[model samples]
Target chain A: DQQVKQNSPSLSVQEGRISILNCDYTNSMFDYFLWYKKYPAEGPTFLISISSIKDKNEDGRFTVFLNKSAKHLSLHIVPSQPGDSAVYFCAASKGSNYQLIWGAGTKLIIKP
Target chain B: EPEVTQTPSHQVTQMGQEVILRCVPISNHLYFYWYRQILGQKVEFLVSFYNNEISEKSEIFDDQFSVERPDGSNFTLKIRSTKLEDSAMYFCASSEDRGQGHQPQHFGDGTRLSIL
Candidate 1:
Protein backbone atom coordinates (compact mmCIF):
# COMPACT_ATOMS: atom_id res chain seq x y z
CA ASP A 1 0.00 0.00 0.00
CA GLN A 2 1.28 3.47 -0.88
CA GLN A 3 0.84 5.54 2.22
CA VAL A 4 2.80 8.40 0.64
CA LYS A 5 2.22 9.26 -3.00
CA GLN A 6 4.03 11.66 -5.35
CA ASN A 7 1.52 11.73 -8.18
CA SER A 8 3.84 13.39 -10.67
CA PRO A 9 6.17 10.85 -12.20
CA SER A 10 8.22 13.62 -13.74
CA LEU A 11 8.33 17.40 -14.12
CA SER A 12 10.34 19.78 -16.28
CA VAL A 13 10.90 23.41 -15.42
CA GLN A 14 13.07 26.18 -16.78
CA GLU A 15 16.14 27.11 -14.83
CA GLY A 16 15.70 30.25 -12.69
CA ARG A 17 11.98 29.48 -12.36
CA ILE A 18 10.17 27.98 -9.43
CA SER A 19 9.56 24.22 -9.40
CA ILE A 20 6.83 22.73 -7.30
CA LEU A 21 6.59 19.06 -6.34
CA ASN A 22 3.55 17.72 -4.56
CA CYS A 23 3.01 14.79 -2.19
CA ASP A 24 -0.08 13.25 -0.62
CA TYR A 25 -0.40 10.83 2.24
CA THR A 26 -3.20 8.59 3.41
CA ASN A 27 -1.99 8.23 6.98
CA SER A 28 -2.83 11.13 9.25
CA MET A 29 -0.76 9.67 12.01
CA PHE A 30 2.38 10.89 10.29
CA ASP A 31 3.59 13.91 12.21
CA TYR A 32 6.90 14.68 10.53
CA PHE A 33 7.55 15.08 6.82
CA LEU A 34 10.77 15.38 4.81
CA TRP A 35 11.97 15.86 1.27
CA TYR A 36 15.01 14.09 -0.12
CA LYS A 37 16.81 14.58 -3.42
CA LYS A 38 18.70 11.82 -5.18
CA TYR A 39 20.96 11.77 -8.19
CA PRO A 40 21.83 8.86 -10.44
CA ALA A 41 23.84 6.13 -8.69
CA GLU A 42 23.79 8.08 -5.45
CA GLY A 43 21.77 7.59 -2.31
CA PRO A 44 19.10 10.10 -1.33
CA THR A 45 20.26 13.40 0.14
CA PHE A 46 18.22 15.12 2.81
CA LEU A 47 16.81 18.43 1.58
CA ILE A 48 14.37 19.70 4.17
CA SER A 49 11.68 18.64 6.64
CA ILE A 50 8.63 19.93 8.48
CA SER A 51 6.78 18.98 11.64
CA SER A 52 3.03 18.52 11.74
CA ILE A 53 2.74 21.45 14.10
CA LYS A 54 4.09 23.83 11.49
CA ASP A 55 2.62 24.88 8.15
CA LYS A 56 5.82 25.81 6.37
CA ASN A 57 9.59 25.65 6.66
CA GLU A 58 12.15 27.30 4.43
CA ASP A 59 15.88 27.00 3.93
CA GLY A 60 17.70 29.11 1.40
CA ARG A 61 15.92 28.56 -1.89
CA PHE A 62 13.92 25.51 -0.87
CA THR A 63 10.65 25.73 1.01
CA VAL A 64 8.31 22.97 2.14
CA PHE A 65 4.63 23.62 2.81
CA LEU A 66 2.48 21.18 4.75
CA ASN A 67 -1.31 21.13 4.79
CA LYS A 68 -2.17 18.84 7.64
CA SER A 69 -5.91 19.08 7.17
CA ALA A 70 -5.61 17.85 3.61
CA LYS A 71 -2.86 15.33 4.31
CA HIS A 72 -0.81 16.94 1.59
CA LEU A 73 2.57 18.69 1.29
CA SER A 74 4.54 20.43 -1.40
CA LEU A 75 8.16 21.38 -1.91
CA HIS A 76 8.97 24.60 -3.67
CA ILE A 77 12.40 25.36 -5.09
CA VAL A 78 12.74 28.95 -6.18
CA PRO A 79 15.10 29.95 -8.97
CA SER A 80 15.68 26.31 -9.70
CA GLN A 81 19.22 25.52 -10.68
CA PRO A 82 20.57 22.84 -12.95
CA GLY A 83 21.85 21.05 -9.90
CA ASP A 84 18.27 20.73 -8.69
CA SER A 85 17.44 18.29 -11.46
CA ALA A 86 17.06 15.03 -9.56
CA VAL A 87 14.53 12.68 -8.11
CA TYR A 88 12.66 14.15 -5.16
CA PHE A 89 11.08 11.86 -2.56
CA CYS A 90 8.61 12.70 0.17
CA ALA A 91 8.74 10.76 3.44
CA ALA A 92 6.82 10.89 6.68
CA SER A 93 6.82 9.28 10.10
CA LYS A 94 4.76 9.40 13.26
CA GLY A 95 5.70 10.62 16.72
CA SER A 96 9.26 9.56 17.59
CA ASN A 97 9.07 6.72 15.05
CA TYR A 98 12.25 5.83 13.22
CA GLN A 99 10.51 4.33 10.24
CA LEU A 100 9.85 6.70 7.33
CA ILE A 101 7.11 5.97 4.83
CA TRP A 102 8.29 7.19 1.41
CA GLY A 103 6.71 8.12 -1.89
CA ALA A 104 7.61 6.71 -5.31
CA GLY A 105 9.49 9.98 -6.04
CA THR A 106 9.20 12.71 -8.68
CA LYS A 107 11.90 13.22 -11.25
CA LEU A 108 12.49 16.97 -11.56
CA ILE A 109 14.26 18.19 -14.66
CA ILE A 110 15.55 21.73 -14.86
CA LYS A 111 15.98 22.83 -18.43
CA PRO A 112 18.16 25.75 -19.30
CA GLU B 1 30.75 16.92 7.02
CA PRO B 2 30.66 13.25 7.98
CA GLU B 3 28.64 10.88 5.80
CA VAL B 4 27.61 7.23 5.94
CA THR B 5 29.79 4.87 3.95
CA GLN B 6 28.93 1.43 2.55
CA THR B 7 31.27 -1.24 1.24
CA PRO B 8 31.31 -3.38 -1.87
CA SER B 9 29.61 -1.02 -4.28
CA HIS B 10 28.33 -4.04 -6.20
CA GLN B 11 27.92 -7.68 -5.18
CA VAL B 12 26.93 -10.71 -7.20
CA THR B 13 25.88 -13.87 -5.39
CA GLN B 14 24.26 -17.08 -6.49
CA MET B 15 20.72 -17.80 -5.39
CA GLY B 16 20.47 -19.53 -2.01
CA GLN B 17 23.93 -18.29 -1.06
CA GLU B 18 24.53 -16.13 1.94
CA VAL B 19 25.66 -12.54 1.46
CA ILE B 20 26.61 -9.67 3.71
CA LEU B 21 26.55 -5.93 3.10
CA ARG B 22 28.51 -3.62 5.36
CA CYS B 23 28.15 0.02 6.35
CA VAL B 24 29.84 2.58 8.59
CA PRO B 25 27.58 5.35 9.74
CA ILE B 26 28.69 8.80 10.80
CA SER B 27 30.63 8.58 14.04
CA ASN B 28 28.27 10.70 16.11
CA HIS B 29 24.95 9.33 14.83
CA LEU B 30 22.98 7.04 17.12
CA TYR B 31 20.33 5.60 14.83
CA PHE B 32 20.97 3.36 11.85
CA TYR B 33 18.76 1.91 9.14
CA TRP B 34 18.74 -0.38 6.12
CA TYR B 35 16.67 0.15 3.00
CA ARG B 36 16.48 -1.43 -0.42
CA GLN B 37 15.16 -0.33 -3.79
CA ILE B 38 14.46 -2.66 -6.66
CA LEU B 39 14.72 -1.53 -10.26
CA GLY B 40 11.96 0.95 -11.06
CA GLN B 41 10.43 0.56 -7.59
CA LYS B 42 10.10 2.73 -4.51
CA VAL B 43 12.68 2.54 -1.77
CA GLU B 44 11.55 0.10 0.93
CA PHE B 45 12.65 0.16 4.54
CA LEU B 46 14.02 -3.07 5.94
CA VAL B 47 15.08 -2.46 9.51
CA SER B 48 16.17 0.14 12.05
CA PHE B 49 18.79 -0.38 14.71
CA TYR B 50 19.60 1.50 17.92
CA ASN B 51 21.27 0.65 21.22
CA ASN B 52 22.46 -2.61 19.70
CA GLU B 53 18.89 -3.82 19.19
CA ILE B 54 16.24 -3.69 16.52
CA SER B 55 13.97 -0.70 17.00
CA GLU B 56 11.65 -1.28 14.04
CA LYS B 57 11.38 -3.37 10.93
CA SER B 58 9.14 -3.84 7.93
CA GLU B 59 7.50 -7.00 6.61
CA ILE B 60 10.19 -7.19 3.99
CA PHE B 61 12.61 -8.10 6.75
CA ASP B 62 11.72 -11.75 6.95
CA ASP B 63 13.41 -14.67 8.66
CA GLN B 64 16.26 -14.75 6.18
CA PHE B 65 17.38 -11.19 6.82
CA SER B 66 19.52 -10.06 9.74
CA VAL B 67 21.43 -6.97 10.94
CA GLU B 68 24.39 -6.55 13.25
CA ARG B 69 26.76 -4.01 14.68
CA PRO B 70 29.85 -6.17 14.72
CA ASP B 71 32.12 -3.31 15.79
CA GLY B 72 31.95 0.26 16.97
CA SER B 73 32.26 1.50 13.39
CA ASN B 74 30.48 -1.20 11.44
CA PHE B 75 26.87 -2.22 10.79
CA THR B 76 26.08 -5.16 8.59
CA LEU B 77 23.07 -6.74 6.91
CA LYS B 78 23.29 -10.48 6.27
CA ILE B 79 20.89 -12.35 4.08
CA ARG B 80 21.00 -16.03 4.86
CA SER B 81 19.80 -17.89 1.68
CA THR B 82 19.01 -15.12 -0.65
CA LYS B 83 16.45 -15.33 -3.42
CA LEU B 84 16.63 -13.77 -6.86
CA GLU B 85 14.02 -11.28 -5.78
CA ASP B 86 16.38 -10.00 -3.12
CA SER B 87 18.61 -8.44 -5.71
CA ALA B 88 18.42 -4.70 -5.26
CA MET B 89 20.31 -1.59 -4.22
CA TYR B 90 20.71 -1.70 -0.45
CA PHE B 91 21.23 1.62 1.34
CA CYS B 92 22.50 2.44 4.82
CA ALA B 93 21.43 5.54 6.70
CA SER B 94 22.03 7.23 10.04
CA SER B 95 20.54 10.04 12.10
CA GLU B 96 21.13 11.86 15.35
CA ASP B 97 19.11 11.45 18.51
CA ARG B 98 15.40 12.05 18.03
CA GLY B 99 15.03 13.47 21.53
CA GLN B 100 16.08 16.86 20.26
CA GLY B 101 13.76 16.98 17.24
CA HIS B 102 13.26 15.24 13.95
CA GLN B 103 16.79 14.77 12.67
CA PRO B 104 17.16 14.25 8.97
CA GLN B 105 18.60 10.90 7.95
CA HIS B 106 21.76 10.81 5.89
CA PHE B 107 22.24 7.92 3.46
CA GLY B 108 25.22 6.15 2.01
CA ASP B 109 25.87 5.55 -1.68
CA GLY B 110 24.37 2.04 -1.32
CA THR B 111 25.54 -1.39 -2.41
CA ARG B 112 24.01 -2.95 -5.49
CA LEU B 113 23.34 -6.65 -4.86
CA SER B 114 22.76 -8.93 -7.82
CA ILE B 115 21.67 -12.45 -7.02
CA LEU B 116 22.52 -14.91 -9.72
Candidate 2:
Protein backbone atom coordinates (compact mmCIF):
# COMPACT_ATOMS: atom_id res chain seq x y z
CA ASP A 1 0.00 0.00 0.00
CA GLN A 2 1.38 3.37 -1.05
CA GLN A 3 -0.77 5.41 1.26
CA VAL A 4 2.13 7.47 2.57
CA LYS A 5 4.92 8.61 0.26
CA GLN A 6 8.21 10.42 0.72
CA ASN A 7 9.23 11.28 -2.79
CA SER A 8 12.76 12.23 -1.86
CA PRO A 9 15.00 9.21 -1.55
CA SER A 10 17.88 11.26 -0.15
CA LEU A 11 18.71 14.75 1.05
CA SER A 12 22.06 16.49 1.57
CA VAL A 13 22.53 19.56 3.72
CA GLN A 14 25.46 21.57 4.97
CA GLU A 15 26.13 21.74 8.66
CA GLY A 16 24.09 24.49 10.35
CA ARG A 17 21.75 24.67 7.36
CA ILE A 18 18.11 23.71 7.21
CA SER A 19 16.86 20.34 6.00
CA ILE A 20 13.25 20.02 5.03
CA LEU A 21 11.77 16.58 4.33
CA ASN A 22 8.33 16.25 2.86
CA CYS A 23 5.68 13.53 3.05
CA ASP A 24 2.24 13.04 1.53
CA TYR A 25 -0.62 10.76 2.42
CA THR A 26 -3.67 9.66 0.51
CA ASN A 27 -5.80 8.59 3.44
CA SER A 28 -7.95 11.29 5.01
CA MET A 29 -8.82 9.08 7.95
CA PHE A 30 -5.30 9.49 9.29
CA ASP A 31 -5.64 11.87 12.21
CA TYR A 32 -2.22 11.44 13.73
CA PHE A 33 1.08 11.97 11.93
CA LEU A 34 4.51 11.20 13.36
CA TRP A 35 8.14 11.37 12.32
CA TYR A 36 10.69 8.75 13.32
CA LYS A 37 14.45 8.71 13.08
CA LYS A 38 16.40 5.48 12.66
CA TYR A 39 20.04 4.60 12.53
CA PRO A 40 21.62 1.47 11.12
CA ALA A 41 20.95 -1.67 13.18
CA GLU A 42 18.58 0.13 15.53
CA GLY A 43 14.84 0.59 15.88
CA PRO A 44 13.07 3.81 15.02
CA THR A 45 13.05 6.53 17.65
CA PHE A 46 10.09 8.85 17.81
CA LEU A 47 11.02 12.41 17.06
CA ILE A 48 7.83 14.45 16.87
CA SER A 49 4.17 14.25 15.98
CA ILE A 50 1.36 16.54 14.80
CA SER A 51 -2.35 15.97 15.19
CA SER A 52 -4.75 16.76 12.38
CA ILE A 53 -6.39 19.49 14.41
CA LYS A 54 -3.13 21.41 14.62
CA ASP A 55 -1.17 22.92 11.78
CA LYS A 56 2.26 23.07 13.39
CA ASN A 57 4.26 21.55 16.24
CA GLU A 58 7.83 22.25 17.22
CA ASP A 59 10.46 20.81 19.53
CA GLY A 60 13.82 22.50 19.79
CA ARG A 61 15.42 22.46 16.36
CA PHE A 62 12.81 20.18 14.86
CA THR A 63 9.46 21.42 13.63
CA VAL A 64 6.59 19.57 11.94
CA PHE A 65 4.05 21.32 9.77
CA LEU A 66 0.78 19.69 8.81
CA ASN A 67 -1.52 20.78 6.03
CA LYS A 68 -4.55 18.59 6.48
CA SER A 69 -6.42 20.02 3.55
CA ALA A 70 -3.53 19.21 1.23
CA LYS A 71 -2.82 15.89 2.94
CA HIS A 72 0.84 16.82 3.31
CA LEU A 73 3.34 17.25 6.13
CA SER A 74 6.95 18.31 6.39
CA LEU A 75 9.71 17.98 8.95
CA HIS A 76 12.19 20.82 9.24
CA ILE A 77 15.49 20.43 11.01
CA VAL A 78 17.28 23.72 11.56
CA PRO A 79 21.01 23.97 12.31
CA SER A 80 21.41 20.45 10.99
CA GLN A 81 24.32 18.59 12.55
CA PRO A 82 26.17 15.43 11.65
CA GLY A 83 24.27 13.58 14.34
CA ASP A 84 21.09 14.33 12.46
CA SER A 85 22.20 12.13 9.59
CA ALA A 86 19.84 9.18 9.46
CA VAL A 87 16.76 7.84 7.74
CA TYR A 88 13.59 9.82 8.52
CA PHE A 89 10.27 8.05 8.13
CA CYS A 90 6.82 9.63 7.99
CA ALA A 91 3.94 7.65 9.40
CA ALA A 92 0.20 8.24 9.68
CA SER A 93 -2.44 6.52 11.76
CA LYS A 94 -6.21 6.64 11.92
CA GLY A 95 -7.95 7.30 15.17
CA SER A 96 -7.91 4.42 17.64
CA ASN A 97 -5.99 2.24 15.15
CA TYR A 98 -2.68 0.65 15.97
CA GLN A 99 -1.59 0.21 12.40
CA LEU A 100 0.62 3.03 11.08
CA ILE A 101 0.94 3.67 7.39
CA TRP A 102 4.63 4.29 6.69
CA GLY A 103 6.39 6.00 3.85
CA ALA A 104 9.62 5.01 2.19
CA GLY A 105 12.19 6.83 4.31
CA THR A 106 14.38 9.68 3.19
CA LYS A 107 18.06 9.37 4.02
CA LEU A 108 19.48 12.65 5.31
CA ILE A 109 23.18 13.40 5.12
CA ILE A 110 24.83 16.31 6.86
CA LYS A 111 28.06 17.67 5.40
CA PRO A 112 30.65 19.39 7.53
CA GLU B 1 13.27 6.46 31.59
CA PRO B 2 11.47 3.16 31.11
CA GLU B 3 11.98 1.35 27.81
CA VAL B 4 10.81 -1.83 26.16
CA THR B 5 13.19 -4.79 26.26
CA GLN B 6 13.55 -7.52 23.66
CA THR B 7 15.67 -10.68 23.80
CA PRO B 8 17.74 -12.52 21.21
CA SER B 9 19.28 -9.63 19.33
CA HIS B 10 19.82 -11.97 16.42
CA GLN B 11 18.59 -15.49 15.63
CA VAL B 12 19.28 -17.86 12.76
CA THR B 13 17.07 -20.88 12.21
CA GLN B 14 16.27 -23.32 9.46
CA MET B 15 13.23 -22.65 7.35
CA GLY B 16 9.96 -24.20 8.61
CA GLN B 17 11.24 -24.15 12.19
CA GLU B 18 9.09 -22.37 14.69
CA VAL B 19 10.48 -19.20 16.23
CA ILE B 20 9.32 -17.23 19.20
CA LEU B 21 10.37 -13.63 19.78
CA ARG B 22 10.05 -12.23 23.26
CA CYS B 23 9.49 -8.75 24.63
CA VAL B 24 8.83 -6.93 27.89
CA PRO B 25 6.82 -3.77 27.54
CA ILE B 26 7.16 -0.78 29.79
CA SER B 27 5.97 -1.32 33.33
CA ASN B 28 3.20 1.26 33.32
CA HIS B 29 2.24 0.83 29.68
CA LEU B 30 -1.04 -0.84 28.85
CA TYR B 31 -0.83 -1.24 25.08
CA PHE B 32 1.58 -3.62 23.35
CA TYR B 33 2.48 -3.94 19.68
CA TRP B 34 4.66 -5.92 17.29
CA TYR B 35 6.10 -4.51 14.11
CA ARG B 36 8.62 -5.80 11.58
CA GLN B 37 10.92 -4.26 9.03
CA ILE B 38 12.43 -6.20 6.21
CA LEU B 39 15.75 -5.02 4.85
CA GLY B 40 15.22 -1.91 2.72
CA GLN B 41 11.50 -1.93 3.40
CA LYS B 42 9.20 0.31 5.42
CA VAL B 43 8.16 -0.74 8.90
CA GLU B 44 4.99 -2.84 8.89
CA PHE B 45 2.62 -3.36 11.79
CA LEU B 46 1.85 -6.98 12.67
CA VAL B 47 -0.53 -6.77 15.59
CA SER B 48 -1.55 -4.75 18.61
CA PHE B 49 -2.61 -6.16 21.97
CA TYR B 50 -4.56 -4.46 24.71
CA ASN B 51 -6.06 -5.89 27.89
CA ASN B 52 -4.60 -9.32 27.00
CA GLU B 53 -6.48 -9.46 23.73
CA ILE B 54 -5.63 -8.50 20.18
CA SER B 55 -7.27 -5.19 19.45
CA GLU B 56 -6.18 -5.07 15.83
CA LYS B 57 -4.04 -6.98 13.35
CA SER B 58 -2.71 -6.40 9.88
CA GLU B 59 -3.12 -8.58 6.82
CA ILE B 60 0.38 -9.91 7.36
CA PHE B 61 -0.70 -11.36 10.68
CA ASP B 62 -2.22 -14.65 9.60
CA ASP B 63 -3.02 -17.99 11.20
CA GLN B 64 0.68 -18.80 11.33
CA PHE B 65 1.26 -15.83 13.61
CA SER B 66 0.06 -15.38 17.16
CA VAL B 67 0.69 -12.92 20.02
CA GLU B 68 0.31 -13.53 23.71
CA ARG B 69 0.97 -11.92 27.04
CA PRO B 70 1.90 -15.03 28.98
CA ASP B 71 2.67 -13.16 32.16
CA GLY B 72 2.04 -9.72 33.61
CA SER B 73 4.92 -7.95 31.88
CA ASN B 74 5.82 -10.10 28.90
CA PHE B 75 4.40 -9.99 25.37
CA THR B 76 5.45 -12.57 22.84
CA LEU B 77 5.00 -13.21 19.13
CA LYS B 78 5.22 -16.69 17.69
CA ILE B 79 5.42 -17.95 14.16
CA ARG B 80 4.20 -21.52 13.87
CA SER B 81 6.30 -22.18 10.77
CA THR B 82 8.89 -19.80 9.47
CA LYS B 83 9.53 -19.09 5.81
CA LEU B 84 12.30 -17.30 3.97
CA GLU B 85 10.07 -14.23 3.76
CA ASP B 86 9.73 -14.13 7.54
CA SER B 87 13.32 -13.00 8.06
CA ALA B 88 13.27 -9.46 9.37
CA MET B 89 13.77 -7.26 12.39
CA TYR B 90 10.92 -7.61 14.85
CA PHE B 91 10.27 -4.61 17.09
CA CYS B 92 8.21 -4.41 20.26
CA ALA B 93 6.60 -1.22 21.42
CA SER B 94 4.32 0.06 24.17
CA SER B 95 2.19 3.05 25.00
CA GLU B 96 0.58 4.39 28.13
CA ASP B 97 -2.86 4.24 26.54
CA ARG B 98 -4.52 3.77 23.21
CA GLY B 99 -6.79 6.22 21.35
CA GLN B 100 -6.42 8.68 24.16
CA GLY B 101 -5.17 11.63 22.18
CA HIS B 102 -1.48 11.59 21.22
CA GLN B 103 0.20 8.68 22.92
CA PRO B 104 3.33 7.86 20.96
CA GLN B 105 4.62 4.31 21.20
CA HIS B 106 8.12 3.68 22.48
CA PHE B 107 10.08 1.01 20.61
CA GLY B 108 12.74 -1.51 21.49
CA ASP B 109 16.05 -2.00 19.69
CA GLY B 110 14.51 -5.00 17.95
CA THR B 111 15.32 -8.69 17.40
CA ARG B 112 16.72 -9.64 14.03
CA LEU B 113 15.43 -13.00 12.80
CA SER B 114 17.14 -14.82 9.99
CA ILE B 115 15.78 -17.86 8.16
CA LEU B 116 18.27 -20.28 6.72
Give the candidate number with the greatest DockQ. Answer: 1
The number of clashing residue pairs in each candidate reads: 0, 0
Candidate 1 residue runs with Cα over 4 Å from true position: none
- RMSD (Å) per prediction: 0.8, 1.1
Write model 1 residue lDDT over B1-116, tens digit each, in one string: 89999999999999999999999999999999999999999899999999999999999999999999999999999999999999999999999989878888899999999999
Residue pairs with backbone atoms closer than 3 Å in model 2 (clashes): none
What digit string (tens of lDDT, one per residue) describes model 2 on residues B54-98?
999999999999999999989999998899999999999888775
Worst lDDT run of 10 residues, candidate 1 chain A, spans A93-102
Q: Which ten residues in a row have the lowest lDDT in candidate 1 chain B?
A: B96-105
Q: For model 1, name the residue pairs that clash.
A: none
Name the docking class for model 1.
medium
Model 2 per-residue lDDT tens digits across residues A43-98? 88989998899999999999999998899999999989999999999999995346
The most accurate candidate by lDDT is: 1
After superposing candidate 2 on the true structure, give the runs of residues whose Cα lies further than 4 Å from its correct spot: none
Local distance difference test, each candidate: 0.95, 0.92
Q: Give the candidate number with the greatest TM-score.
A: 1
